[model samples]
Target: MTTLDGQTALVTGAGRGLGRGIALALAAAGARVVLVSRTGAEIESAAQEIRSHGGEAVAVPCDVLDLARFEAVLDGVGPVDVLVNNAGTNAPMPFVAVSPDTFDTIFDLNVRSTYFLTQAVVARMIAAGTGGSVITVSSQMGQVGAADRSVYCAAKHAVEGMTKALAVELGPHGIRVNTIAPGYVETPLTAPYFADQEFRADTLRRIPLGRLGLVAEVAAAAVFLADPAAAFVTGSSLVIDGGYTAQ
Candidate 1:
């Protein structure tokens, strides 16, 4: 039997990229997945792909930044056994040139959404009297500072803090909260940056693995943390940066 058999998982921003990869991985482990995203078409397409692979999945279109709509989306999905707060946005601008609006946009989606959504999901998990996992997709930026990523780093740092606090508060209720910090995964969001030969070379030089990470690699980490194998683990951040942080 699969590790996640008989569980229900919700992966936000699951239309594509890292979120989609995590959703598919969870489904492969025998969980019925709920794909949440702002774009209905993308989520639907992803759900269909999961179905084609004999995995059970459904698409739910909702913006994470909108609490009301997010609550509605939660209601539509009913009780969720796992909630992957993977929806996030980043505007890479120098600290001196960053605007309030830019900061708010990133925090609203990355921090606010994660905060409230976890509250909602943990409430349900408490009521059901069963343990559940809440995994947030953080970044290496959260751990270390980087140029042109001040706001992004702040948001992810907040996410890491929240993860710890939530884990402490929810431990009594059998709910696990953790953050996955990826170094530099190859995704649609980072594709442009990776396309630049100079940038790519610089990034590769930092990673001891000498290559960029795959979405599937990050997804596998999610699966490990979400499954019973990690039952004793909580209030932690898993760094999947291929030795970038090691240096």
Candidate 2:
């Protein structure tokens, strides 16, 4: 049985969408969850929902892009048995149109924040002598490229590489590191893009599943990765792209 009873999980960007879904999943499995997001209200609402469902959760509002504040956030939470680095952003622009500012913004959140957060959390995990699970929420774009998504792709690709390297470094301490590379998921942030006729059509045509993924679907995958059943699974990507990249 895959159980997370008595575990503690910290999910970044848990205000809504995929992060909220992942937090709910982990809490449902009996883990005490800490929900982190830049918006205080959003994260508080998420925490309330979990508590209403008989789960343990705390809402912490902090901009993850500010590395110092983020490190402090982790310090307040103490040792985490599971760390879900789900906070990230994307700016789709033509390769030629992408400016240094655009590249820096995406990479700062998607790659830099994730890297440092993992480092801080893992240090506590090692000191506590408790092997933990680190799940980085990446995207199918990491594995393949797309039009007007150059910077996003670059950031995700960097994450894929970082995961592999971290896994090898942490494996000796029994800490596992991996990423969940999902396809186009219907979220508030992505709804606008999917609403466009041309964008929706092109996206659906590429996915063999012929539809967008649900936040719950991605959440379930994270649970699987965080559970003990996946003890031997490290440095791997659970691709949930509905065959979008299969071609």
Candidate 3:
């Protein structure tokens, strides 16, 4: 593992699933990890898990949508060297059935809050004069749309656009901005969806690898982006989709 011994990493939505996996990987790699989630007990458990393995970690509970409270809590975390904008929510519905509230709920957390949170973190990185990496956990849907997922596609696509713009703007400051787009990863959030045999078979058929992605697989991508070895990589999308998007 490329060591991040003295660096600090903050991962949002880190209570479980991909966020938890990424937080664990970063901690194992030696970065002091700050795990943020709306659920206090969950993140606290994750933090304790890291500490059990001799890694440094901190758990912070806050709703990312609450900007004022988030910012206030962030102030106490000190300098962050790597930021993973991983907190997001997706509620599937047909395009015509999408109410205004549904759209707002999806876009607010997936796009709006993520955009502003990154802005805040990037600003602090600039002020501190320390170069860093900003990684957003996007989705293959961001590059291609699917039925009943138009809103999610829109939000992820917006994230892709924002990342590129930020990369160009922050390149001079040595801040790298990129995204990790995963396709149908098997997490607690998605396990229920797989209960339908047809859906599971159809999903696997689309992926050339013919299998669901592992949390560790996606977490490793986050580690790669944060490592010094990836210093030259920015404004890029690392798609861990088992070739799903390739088709």
Candidate 4:
């Protein structure tokens, strides 16, 4: 495992769930972390938790949807050696019932935010000649479609495509871009859905491993992709879905 010692990593949506887990993992691996989220106090608490473990971390309250501000992200974050685009949301709805607002909301956060945020960070990386790793948090839905999740699936698929294209374009600069697509990760936002036994049982049946994924598991993958040891990896989707997509 390549240590990220002396590296500075910026992770969006670091207030909770997979984002928070990834931030902590990167910090544990010796990277100074910048925790970004729309909520200030939440990420601040998370940052303090990292500091409690003697890891360097800073809470940066930010909305990645603000592309304009991302142009100046370096101004607030200084130099980011690793960029994790993890801020996203999903709303499951029947395809026919998906409204324009629902579509826009999902796409704006999942697709547009991911595209421009990476653009800003990679641009800065290029100018400084400091190549970095960009790990986008995608979903198994990106690879296969699901009922009532049409909009969400589309957004993730768009991210999957964008990541590949960006990886190719940024490879010349030594910047690596890839995505981590996890399936059925148990998080706060998903705990409610799993409360319904039918949904839970069906989801479990599809996963060969017989359980939902853990945030720590996904976080571990993010660390691997961010490490310098993965220098040769790019335009790839590392799926941590317990063989859900294998079928």
By TM-score, who's the top model here?
3
Would you list the C-alpha lDDT of every candidate in the order shown? 0.92, 0.93, 0.95, 0.91
* Candidate 4 accuracy as TM-score: 0.97
The TM-score that candidate 2 achieves is 0.98
Once fitted onto the true fold, the runs of candidate 1 whose alpha carbons sit more than 4 angstroms away are none
lDDT of 4: 0.91
Which lDDT tens digits does candidate 1 get at residues 1-247? 4899989999999999999999999999999999999999999998999999898999988888778887887788888999999999899989999998998989999999889988888888999999899999999988988899999999999999999998998999899999999989999999999999999999999999999999999999999989999999999999999998877
Score residue 62 of candidate 2 by CA lDDT: 90
Q: What are the per-residue Cα lDDT tens digits for candidate 4 across 58-86?
A: 98777888777665666877888999999
* Evaluation by lDDT, superior candidate among 1 and 4: 1
Candidate 3 lDDT by residue in tens digits, 69-120? 8888779999999999999999898899999999999999999999999988
* lDDT comparing candidate 2 with the true structure: 0.93
Off-target runs (Cα >4 Å) in candidate 3 are none
3 or 4: which has the higher lDDT? 3
Using lDDT as the measure, the top candidate is 3
**What is the full ranking by lDDT, best candidate first?**
3, 2, 1, 4
TM-score of each: 0.98, 0.98, 0.99, 0.97
List pairs with backbone clashes in candidate 1: none
